[model samples]
Target chain A: MYAIDIKDIKKIYKGGVEALKGISLQVKKGDFYALLGPNGAGKSTLIGIISSLVNKTSGKISVFGYDLESQLEQAKAKIGLVPQEFNFNQFEPPLQILVNQAGYYGIKRQEALIRAEKYLKQLDLWGKRDQPSRELSGGMKRRLMIARALMHEPCLLILDEPTAGVDIEVRRTMWAFLTELNKQGVTIILTTHYLEEAEMLCRNIGIIDKGCLVENTSMKSLLARLETETFIFDVDPPTHLPSSEFFSIKQVDEVTLEIELDKNQSLNKVFAELSAQGVRVNSMRNKANRLEELFIGLVEKGSKNV
Target chain B: MFNHNYFIALKSIWRKEINRFLRIWVQTLVPPVITMSLYFVIFGNLIGARIGEMNGFDYMSFIVPGLIMMSVITNSYSNVASSFFSAKFQRNVEELLVAPVPNYVIILGYIGGGVTRGLMVGFMVTCVSLFFVDLQIFNIFVLILSVICTSILFSIGGLLNAIFAKTFDDISIIPTFVLTPLTYLGGVFYSINLLPDFWQAVSHFNPVFYMINAFRYGFLGIADVSLIWSFSVIIAFIVALYTLVAVLLSKGIGIRS
Candidate 1:
């Protein structure tokens, strides 16, 4: 059974703001899925509905075949949500927060204590477990939320912008922890603005725009949709630049060039043209993350269509 | 979920609530005791010296039950109101909302906390009363029942207030304007018999009057209203308030988007 199966779910706020308009999607069990969207794209709202934090206006949602309406407890038991905001009691210690969360899921105090310790240690928060959560740094508080969510040992975990304000080191650590958790057969759904993180961790991706699911496909397929790839080259200064019908080249500086190559173009032709100019070929890299380029293109296209 | 799981969830919420108030004991527990002591000093001792006897007993003995009941009612109501509202304001209440615990369990757990605080403050005030008057329990069962039922009733009131409250100021409005007036005019110090017939009839309409009288009956074996009538009013309010809280929770009125 799918970890989460949403069918045409819609959410219109009290003021008639349509946060979501008929979003339907599914994530297979044990899959690491990314739900990517721009600001106010209904990603958090959709996650809120799946976790029962927000009341949906219409349609149905099920977790592991348990209907959210009929079997709310069962469905909720299967999922853990790390919301985008810091929602834990600031005065409470991390240990108390995690243990209390486990208790809410009906775990005994003894077991809750053990699980809390395990998660605290796993999230690199063991030393700070006894400290008030508010005293922790921004990144530490985010990890505490993750530990609290995992205390119940849910089969499906949903993290919404879990590392939004975190530094690179902490974000990488979280990514490793999540990857390890997913490898252990836990279904994970992540919503993030970091397209590079999504490209690295998630196999399948769903892009939401204006409360609609604009692109839902494998990451490989989505990346393949990029019509042109931009690369930045570090080359020896040249008197002239190469010109080609398939490649768009521009001199960025004395020794740097920006080149955009179409899908059907070959780097060999561009290199031969550069060689004719007697400019030494040097190291080159993509101007931007491939997923980021595709994401921008898709969001722009979707906006124009709207 | 299993029955045991529900019990566990209840225990968790109760423990969390208990720890919360206890963690700030000086704020939660100590203030009520101090406030009650001042009342005992001012109302029971200094004022009773001049007032002489009331309801066939010394004025100090007469007002003891009412004072204790006042503490119980106020503490119970405020405990839940502040805790729940703070949770809402901080957005930490989502921890419970997103959990598998049933909504009824959530309600019960918070009520449990409110009752605990109410009774704790009540017990402390009763102990303080002992220093002024040799306390006597006319009916232990009635005393316990009245206090517990009253605490439960007001605790639910607090929950409803917290749910509807948009800001911190909103939570205090009911206690300041509504609760204080009702308790003061509920015949806590002077018996309603001292009022004219019209005012006495008005006292009958104030629910706090029934609660204080029922509790006073437990201590001094005298009441302004019948025991059956008092219980009926308390139970009816409890049922109605509980139903309102349950409906609000099910609708996710103030807690959800």
Candidate 2:
């Protein structure tokens, strides 16, 4: 089942700033979908629309087939949004805030308390339950937001920049927690500037740019589309760089050469050719598939033409 | 997945509202009671003795209802306005907007908090008035209804003010310029009947006048205007303000992209 189905979704703010331009995408049930985009690429705007915080000029959205406009209450009830900004009543304790969120879902006070405790503990925040939200560290605050979203047991969780400012360790912990949640059948939609986070966590990704979707595909397909492999060959200083027809090479530093080689191009052939030229190779390794490289290529290419 | 469980949202909002006001008792509760006591002492006891026997009731008794009404108005308006503005200021409002809770629940929850503060403060002020004058609840039912309704009306008004307010200065502008002026001229300290006929007709237009008069009628069973008119005006204001707020929230007027 599709967890979130957004079709022909368009959002035009006043003064005709088209923040979403008839975007369409589907998030499969239990899938961790990442929306990747640069600043001003409309990732937050799209999340805002799906969460019903931003009004759409026209679109059709459904959560588990409940129409967002017609069956708004139902559609909204199924989805939980964790915004990029930390937004909770600071004066309220973490547990109280979570319980209050449960109340919004019409959960009974007793049940809300139970659920709040359950999620807080799961998020490793139970220890700080009675502390006001303002007292928590930045990472803890983000975790509290996650706990609040989960209190209603929502089927679809949309996190906007969940780890934007978090330390690496905290982000890893959150990633682990979210992975466990996904394993238990919660569908996740996330937007982040961190391409590695998306590359690691999401099975499918969509790249939006200038209020339009520029690319959307499964992780494997997207990486595969980049057919060329990047290789950083560690070499002893050569008198001059090799002009090889087999590879595109650039001297990155005094001792290292960066080469872009297609799959059809063989490193062995380059090594044999290098041996023939008596160029001493110190070390060599194929670069891992990094989304940052791909993202830069895509966004830079797009920006150059416009 | 979209379930329209409005009651759940309502209970959540109401709980937050109650928690917010009750948590800050010194800020929300105590100051109003002290202010009302000062009013009772200076205006009711000290001044009422010099300006005695208006509308066939003791000066202290006549001003008691007005002071209570003033407290209710200020408390109700300030409660929602400040709370909502603070949420906006702190950016916490985004959480509610994204939650499953409907906009109406958000509106009602904040307003409920305001009404709680207003009525609670009003009740305390009424009790304080009792120490200075002989208490006579001439129309207890109307007094209760008037306070409750007026509290709701101004609470809604406060929410509207918060939506329009862009800064801290914006929040105070309404209460200072509009609300304070209306209350002072609302026949709170003096009777409209004692004014010239033209000014009495003008006072009829002040919504607070009806609220205070109706509340006073509840105490003394006497009013400068018809009690029914006072009740009707407060009810009308509630309906009008609720619609405006509902429309603004549904459109995401202040809280959206």
Candidate 3:
């Protein structure tokens, strides 16, 4: 059975805000899935519904074959959610928060203490575990929430924008920790505005837009759909531009050029062409983040369809 | 396994609430003790000295049980109201709602917290009163039962108020307008038999009157209301409030929306 299975979920909030419009999704067991969407695109609402924080207007949902309505305890036991906001008590210390959350899941006091210390040290929060959570820095609080969510060692962990405001270095560290956790066979569903983060960590991607599922596929397959990618080339001053008929090249002054090349087209042919014209390439990279480009394309297409 | 998880959930919530009040002892425990002491000094000593005997007992001892009940009701009501509403306002309630704990367990956990605070404050107030009056218990079981029943009733009332409250203002409105007025008119200060016939009839309608008089009956063997009637009203309110709270939680009313 899938880790998460949502069937025709519809959410019509109070006073007629249709946040989710008959959406269906499935995540296989042990898969690292990314649920991507722009703000107001219903990603958080969908997550809320899955976790039973928000009541749905209509739909069926299940986690690890446990129906949410009929088997709520089993379903809840299988999933852990780190919400977008800091919902923990600010007065409580990180250690207490984790221990309390573990207790909520039936872990005894001694086992909860052990799990709390384990996650606190693993998340680099053991040193400051005694201080009030409000005194912690923003990144520390975010990591604390993750540790608290993981206290029960749920089979499926859902994180909503876990690193939205984190600094680059801290975000990198979080990425490494999350990668290690995923490697240990935890199924994770992550929603993040950072497309590169999704591209790096998530194996499958589901893109939602305007209360509709726009795209859902493997990252490899999704990237494969991109017919053309723009690559920036840094060339020596002696290099001459290739024929405009064969390649779409946009000049970036004396020593640089940008070209939109088809995926089927070979970089070797372009190198041979450049060499024949006395142009030596120094460095080359994509003009835009590949996943970002696809994301924008998908969202724009979805908006147009709307 | 599920039942054990539910039990742990209740324990965790109960511990957290108790910790909260204890951590802020100055706000939760000390203020009530001070306030009740002032009542003892002003009402029991000076005023009672002028009035002398009331209902065949010294005025000081006569009002002691009523004053204790007053503190319990106030503390219990305020504890649950503020705590639950803050959870709603801060949205931390989602933590428990998303857990596998049943709604009844959630209500029971919070009620336990409120009852603890009420009982703690009541006990402290009772200790303070002993300095002003030589107290005697007419019946130990009746006294314990009255105080607990009254505390639980008010705590449940507070929870219901909190569930309906949308803002901080909404939480305080009922206490200030409805609760305080009803409490003061509940005969904590005077026996209803001393009042005029019409007002005495009206006093019988105030639910706090039953709680206070039943509690007073435990102390001085004198009551303005029947113990059976008082116990019945308090238990009925507790049952009705519990049912409502459970229903509200099940429907995902104000908190969920």
For chain B alone, what TM-score does every candidate structure achieve against the true structure? Answer: 0.98, 0.96, 0.97
Docking class of 1: high
DockQ, computed on Cα atoms, for candidate 3: 0.75
Candidate topping lDDT: 1
Tens digit per residue, CA lDDT, model 2, B1-257: 33446777776777788788899899999999999899889988888899979899888888888889999999999999998889888877876776667677788788888888898898888788879988899988998999999899999999999998889999899999999999999988888988999999899899999999999899889888888788889999999999999999887887776
- Sorted on lDDT, best first, the list reads 1, 3, 2
- Residue-wise C-alpha lDDT for candidate 3, range A7-109, written one tens digit per residue: 9999999899999999999999989999999999999999999999999999999999999999998899888899999999888889988888888888888
Q: What digit string (tens of lDDT, one per residue) describes model 2 on residues A186-222? A: 9999998878888889999988888878888898788
Clashes of 3: 0
**Candidate fnat values, all:** 0.97, 0.80, 0.82
Instruction: Name the 10 consecutive residues with the lowest summed lDDT in model 1 chain A.
Output: A238-247
Q: Which ten contiguous residues of candidate 2 chain A have the minimum total lDDT?
A: A285-294
Interface C-alpha root-mean-square deviation, candidates in order = 0.5, 2.1, 1.0
CAPRI-style docking class of model 3 based on DockQ? medium
TM-score of each: 0.97, 0.94, 0.95
Error of 3 at B121 (Å): 0.8
